[model samples]
Target: MTLDRSRWQPRTTTFIVLMAAANALLYHAPLFSFAADHLEVGSFSGILTLVTALVALFSSTALLLSLLALVSHRLLKPICMVLAITSSIAVYFVATYQVVLDRTMMGNVQNTNLAESLELFHPKLLVYLALLGLLPAGLLAGVRVEKSPRLRVAAMAASVLVLTVTWGWMASGTWGWIDKNAKRLGGLVMPWSYVMNTVRSAAPKLWQSDVQILLPEAAFTDDEKSVVLLVIGESARAQNFSLYGYERPTNPQLEKAGAEALQSTMASSTYTTASVRCILSHVDSSSEFSTRYEPLPSYLQRHGVDVIWRSKNTGEPPIQVQTYETARELARDCPGPERDYDEVVLTGLEERIRSSSSQKILVVLHQAGSHGPSYSTKYPIHFEVFRQVCESVELGTCSEEELYNAYDNTILYTDQILSRTIDVLKRIPAASPLLIYISDHGESLGEYGLYLHGAPWMIAPDVQKAVPFIVWMSEEFTERRNVHPAQLQAQTAHSQRDIFHTILGALSIQSEVYEEEYDIFNESFSNR
Candidate 1:
């Protein structure tokens, strides 16, 4: 049965319409599913609203595709193929992880290093690409389109007017409902979600100044040696930590070492880049380039304080410091199996502090803690206190218990690392050490069908926003600063924004930019 190849060819307008319909139907399951779950399908008004929304979505997509296909005969097929392939990839992540491709999430995608991105690879992803991407793309490649530019242009203009009227009518009655779910709805629309958001996230970088606005001049209040070790944890949620009343003993080492856990603390954002910037910024500003200022590390370094940054993770803001070391760089001095883990960041830490000539020192250790879907691989085998852990990157394949055990073990490993760090600080009594640990953002583990972080912050669950804030100070540090552990722990309700001012207060650095109200250690204690 031989078929004529000429029969398969269609006009440009027809091809665009078919492609738009295919994309709306095939790649929009998540959007329609969300709509179905929220709308009252049993009622007439809800059904009408749903139908109108669907029509709007289809029409808008068709109009956009029509414009692209009509622009040039040479580039029509290539554009369609690219959209097909990219939409398939976008839908896979949106549906599998239940993540929204908002600006922050898109920023996360751009900021992800190759090693971190590789963790997302799974067999299911390949299946999606083959079926949804390559199949359509291959079909588009073989089809010949008959050009009818004038007719297509006329049809598209009519569509634009019709769609505009239809949207205005729909908005009069359903604007509130649509506005409420705009973030989720915008994030679920295939191709446009990642496409527009990537631009939205990257556009700000263009206007940002190359040089930071330097903060007011600061001076040390005392000549005493002070070292603040700020450990920026990655994807660590407070809900799982035993220190925050979790049933599991995930914080055994931290508890034994007498670390103070502040109960009320929320992350500023659900993603690392924004949350880390907030943690370092002088003010509690939204994730916008307009509010850019000197980060804590750079500000401290400029004030003659020795600042050393050790990172096992990416996504920290631009920093200006004398010493910045990555895990691979630090691996030379560190040996054995633990060297590959986050414990590698602690290589020669005590030696560095002892050898420093500055009276004030700040060492920032950015940890790759509990980054998901390969949680079981994050810690050593000995740290796997819980049994029957999930080893697969496909999170949905694992049972609830398996997923939890693997994630908990990472927290347990984190407990050990923090404890070991405390031990090192304890040995350096002359430096009057202080350890402050807080996650850049929290993680979501099968909560409300959400697997990983980076949902829009307004709608993200508490598990994704609530992070652990732990502090450990030596007796010398407490005495020199005239602060008590009980007083510090008693005053609750903290946030990542407080970190900037708290570090300044602890180091006794006087600056006009330092806000006393934001400093957690300044409740009743005086640094004078």
Candidate 2:
């Protein structure tokens, strides 16, 4: 089996093809597995389409590598080594968490904080790195590439032509299936998924302006001492909440406190950045152009409303406020066993409001509620109401019951935070406090063989898009704003987009940009 070492050098094109083949086989198990589960392999057209799709994937990868190699033989090894390492890490998360590599998911990866990123570390990841990453990288480093730039370029051109022809020929028979599963397929392809998506995610930043477009001038109708606590929950799905008829006691406190759980509410997106932007923007910021406008906090602050943002989690849009505190900074003043948890965001909250001299105040608390796969760690041990919780970050290793219990416990803990937040608002009766709790997005608890969140909105399950939208108005707030809890409960077809206008309506802030149709509280107002 041994060959002469001096004679073992492969041409640049052959080397690139081999590396691409290795990447496709080693890092694309999820892709093939998904295809196997979804594709109709019984029919001849299905088989031909599947085979063509596989060929397309391999050829595309090889073509990309060949083009890189054409740039310089010296660059090929380093580029592939980096790809191998990154692809290994990507596949680990992709397989273990059932998360796909899309532009949004890549954005999430880039936006993730060090603390949150550290939680994903496991021994299995090391194994994947060593076996799939370093081993191939080492082999790539040792391999000899014959300097044949012409061959690489020709090979690349031929691959592109062949792949295009094959794809176009198969399009008639496979277009429906491909279009139906495009997001999933695009997200599962090795190297290309993360590589292409990372570029796609970052490409907008190159041309988009950082300067936010100012909203219309706003004015307060009355000098009412109003306070709005907009609690942005993390990954808290409606399907897990008892208030949403989940048959679980995960929301005992919320149910007992009579929190108005709005029906038919959906998130703007499946990921935090987009969903949070939609929640905070005056208009739906899911569209590219809409993101240029100033967010709710910034807009409200500009109108002389005292805005305070306290975050235990990240991924919110640019917030320009007087007071912005993180979990670590707040933890210094907060003293309790629950200080490490999301309860820290509420520390001294009543006092902060009581001391405020402003006529209107908006306190935004971004909570780390139910963010997984370390769900059991999100809450305090006392909140582990469900037994046999899954403690492992590798969610697939745990039983369905164990995984559910862990995730439910996080929801249970979230219930406590929301109820406690309402209590904080109730004590500040002089402020005419209003509480609005909406999750940035929902999580997938092993539904359709998918775990965690961040699936593309189009393909995401109901559990990933159907978020909990709970609102609680103080007696004073209800009477002053003319927004009854019953009215809010009766409202349907609500979404995260309503949050921006609803807050304005509740505070009686008159603005040209405010839309009555999007405001949930607008119907109850006499003038409206």
Candidate 3:
């Protein structure tokens, strides 16, 4: 069929040109520039370098193929549309992932609501709208010129012109954004920067340096022997088990053990890095720790008592407190036979407990707790406690029952890990004094359109943040280290800020840095 020449009008040409120009300008700003700024990665040199490299690759491909389409009438429009749309989507996903990393690192695992995330980069919204408008305009123009060879040629010419201009604008902005954020983005590589940003943004609260640990003078006495074990669970949201009043019986073992389980009712940050960092450090709700500085592990090691960090998650290693001291005292990280079991963590724990040369050792167990989209992987195969669980990730298509079953199944496995751990602790020759367990943070299971945990803090609630804290005190701990049950329960109301001091206090370690202002064992909880 002969091409229709009549459809190629000045108006059509203008529309194509404007659409392409608008799309390029809008998409690049947020995808590249805004991302750098939000991540505090400085300017164009910082965030755009990686994006520039990627866009350059894609742009070259677009230009080469557009040229090919330039020669063949059959290929031009399809290739151009494909390149433009796909590249735009790619930019969006990259920026979204960075935001996800930012929250995740901060111990938030819940998904950020679309509206809130969009607000953070509102300047880029115009670009997204512009591109959406262009898609239909581009298609209509191509169709109008289909029957006329002359008009087809004219439309193609206009389309390419628009592509060139739009592509240039996006490329240039990417470079400029990178240049602007160069300082902030300095030394931050992809994925790592994304990961750290997530952790940094999700930091809960940090206590000021003024907070002090009020310890009795000459606190050390051979007469008093105390042991405290702090088992830190990773990505463990508190709302998914019977122990936390989850509809399902995910914690039958813990329930049977009769441990005093308390579930907090607020949403904390959304990631292990931020959640644990905040919990382990003496940080309070008012002050945010400058993760860029102040490594917490060193602070713990400076005082007496042994500090051990055992990690199964491979994202970022815990911030180092003191390299030399930690190296000598740290528990070896055995992430399991595969990325799949909670059992691997309990392996060396018992040995470390019994063989400890020090009277007071702080043991940190980081579990692969209920990390979703792959819940089945978090447990031992033998447990198989729940069936019909979500075995795949075609999300939304999976039945609610299936997804929940899979999630609870992970919890079931977690219970086994806890049970076995308790049994081992009970067997520890009554030498150890106490075992305290708390999750790094909580998870969300399809609550408020939230599937995973890392939602933005301003929007996330207590369920996702309220973690489970349990005290497994032995007879020795009760006689020597225990406070009144009433006071201990009241201390549960204390923020995670006290975790650092409570551990030190339970061990009877004297450190000037420990603060009664935030310490759980402080006489404050006693209302004395």
Give, for candidate 2, the lowest lDDT window spanning 10 residues: 519-528
The true-structure Cα RMSD of candidate 2 reads 2.7
Query: What is the TM-score of candidate 3?
Result: 0.59
| Cα lDDT tens digits for candidate 1, 46-74 | 77767666666777777777777656766
lDDT values of the candidates?
0.86, 0.85, 0.54
lDDT of 2 by residue, 409-460 (tens): 9999989998998988888867888889999889887889888889887778
Q: What is the C-alpha RMSD of each candidate to the true structure, in Å?
A: 2.6, 2.7, 13.8
Which lDDT tens digits does candidate 3 get at residues 170-225? 67755665566553332122323343454564433343243333223324435354
- Candidates in descending lDDT order: 1, 2, 3
How many clashes in each candidate? 0, 0, 60
Off by over 4 Å in 3: 1-225, 263-267, 285-296, 314-340, 484-486, 490-492, 521-523, 526-528
Model 1, runs deviating above 4 Å: 1-5, 160-164, 167-176, 287-291, 524-528
What's model 2's lDDT at 359? Answer: 86
Candidate 2 off by > 4 Å: 1-7, 40-47, 149-152, 163-176, 524-528
